[model samples]
Target: MRVSVVICTCGRASILPDTLDTLTVQTQPAHEVIIVATQPSDIPDLTRYTAKMPLRVEFAEKGLPKQRNHALNILSDQCDIVFFIDDDYMPSADALEQLSRAFAALRYAAGMNGTLLADGIHSRGIDASDARSMLRNRPAVGPVPIAIKRNLVGLYGCNMAYRTDAISDTRFDEALPLYGWQEDVDFASRVNGEMVQVNTVSGVHCGTKLGRESSGEMLGYSQVANPIYLSGKGHIPPVFLLKLTMKNILANHLKQLCPEDWIDRAGRARGNRAALKDWIRGRVSPDRLTHVRPSPSGPKP
Candidate 1:
């Protein structure tokens, strides 16, 4: 199967090269690597890497969903399967090879997400060098195990793949906008076939803190609003939405007492409060997040 890799990134030009470096050693080289950025400055010079693999770069408006949709618009006609990985994710050498094997074996699966050997999104971010070391030390294993998850609501955005034909006409919803918190879930849930999880086709989500231009306010708002928006759209069940909302709100509130150095718990708590107020007033909408100005004290670009 012809495989394509798509990375929609913003900011973080400094670390993108390291992610691409990991791709150079992939056992199954991608047929093409398509990168969509908001501006030329969002990525590093790729002239040196072009000789190692087919690379294509394009510019788009900033939002993740919009940028990803732009990638879908320009995908090559020869592409069969497409992998959407984050700019900070580092996949193992055989990640693509295993993905190809899994897709070929699971003929009925429309999409799949590999297991994450290490994910820093939940804590202090991991450095690229540390992530590389972790990948190199992972125990050598045989063929990966694959399972079809009928009840999974979405694929992990950092390392997920989909059959091109299966999602050809399915465009990511642009409503979620920048940072698009749960855009992956919203998109994956709308696809036509079962989603699979491959155990051995793993990677590390460096979850580097840079290049995230969205403020804690924006993310916090989405934490509550996006799930509610998706639930109203019938893409996710109300029970799931309630659980997600409560979890984030509770975490933000509790963490505010002794916030993690890497997170802006207070700002997120304020955003969450605003979202709840809006909900009570019957004014909550995912698009409304775009209007919430970033806090001046929030993380820098």
Candidate 2:
């Protein structure tokens, strides 16, 4: 299979190079690496990597879904599988190789999400050096385990792959705007076949907090509004949406008491309230995030 890697990023120039460096050592090299950035400066100098791999950089309007759709529009015709990975993720050396094998075996799968050896998104965040160390020292494992769970709702956006043909008629929903919290779920649920999870195709999500363009308010609004929007669209069950909505709102409130230095819990809380109000007034929409103004005083410190 001819595999292409797509990375849609913005304001992550500082750490994106580390992710690119790992790709250089992949056991199964990608046919091409397409990077969609909002501006030239959003990506670091790539001249150094031009010789190591087939790399292409393109500019797009800011917004994760929009940037990803831009990549889909320009994908190489020869590409059979397109892997979407975050700018902060680091795949193991054989990840692509294993992913290809899994896809070959599961002929009916439309998409697949790789196992994450270490994910720092839930916590403070992980250092690139530390993430690299974890990847390097991970214990030798058994055969790759691939499963096609009928109930799988979505692929993890940090590291996921899809057959090129499966998405020939699909595009990431631009309605979800920047960060696009549940865009992956919305996309996967709309595609043609089953989604799988493969253990052998693993990676580390450093979840670097820098270069994030979404404010806590915007993210919080997305946390509530996107799920509701998707559920209403019939992409996700209403029960799942309700569970997700309450979980996020409850977490934000509980965390506000002793907020992490890196997180703006107060801003998120305020945004949550705003979204609830909008919902009650029948004005809730993910697009409203584009109109959300930043807090003048910034998030409570």
Candidate 3:
């Protein structure tokens, strides 16, 4: 099958080199490479990398839907399948081939989830050499040496593949959430498909410390708010949303163990206040109550 690998990157040129190298060496090389460089100049050095590579390069304008949606809209017709891998990830040589094989083997499955290998370190930069070291032993999460499958809640956006036809029919929702959050979950929820976790391709998901957003950015807020929005639409329940938000907050705090940066005491307090306020004012969005009823056709796709 002709597969196009889609990578959406924003201002991370340094990491692309390793990502490109891995792609170039894929056992099942992608038919084409379409990069949605969110920033026009984010990859000025693209020519240098594409010079000796067989893959063709393409760019997309950056926006809220992010590069994945941009690439899908433009390239879906050109490729049979579209595989997305993060700029920071290094794919196994056979990752592409395996993902395709999994889909072929499981005709009913719409999407397959690939495993992630986080280094657990926050600050150090990742490179090709580091990827090789991590790959030598094929860590537990490193490579899906065998093919196993199961129904899944969703696929991790960074390392997943989908038939082009699936996405061509309905592009990812741009208005769902932003700042690297929930696009995958929300997309899977809306798309009519059976999700699967597949034991196919696996590779080191490199870690980074310095360049990522610090605490000041309301990443936590978006994580919380997006679920709230989804719940209001009846995609999820309020209690479940609260549980997830609190769990996410606690997990981050546990990882950092820094109260000032991790403890969201005020957020907890404000959450209660907001709930109380909504209850008192009867100002819940219509979606939270009346709109949740199934459509005439039944449950939404």
Q: Could you say which candidate leads in TM-score? A: 1
CA lDDT, candidate 2, residue 200: 71
User: For residues 105-212, what per-residue lDDT tens digits would candidate 2 score against the true structure?
Assistant: 888888999878889887778898998898998877567456635447888899989998998879989889888889998899888888888767878999888877
State the lDDT at 228 in candidate 2: 77
Displacement of the residue 208 alpha carbon in candidate 1, Å: 0.2
Q: Would you estimate the TM-scores of all the predictions? A: 0.96, 0.95, 0.76
Put the candidates in TM-score order, highest first. Answer: 1, 2, 3
Clash number for each model: 0, 0, 2
- The alpha-carbon lDDT assigned to residue 266 of candidate 3 equals 40
- On lDDT, the leading prediction is 1
Ranking by lDDT: 1, 2, 3
Structural RMSD, model 3 = 8.7
What C-alpha lDDT, on a 0 to 100 scale, does residue 13 get in candidate 2? 95
Model 3, 1-301: lDDT tens per residue?
A: 8778877776677767778887777778787887777556566476655754555445655543556777776774887778877777788777788777777777777777766554423334465687767665664533323335555555677777887777657666565433445667667666667777765567777754423433222344455555656666564446756787678656544644443332343443333334334546755321222122222331101
Better of 1 and 2 by lDDT: 1
- Note the residue pairs that clash in candidate 1: none
lDDT of 1: 0.87
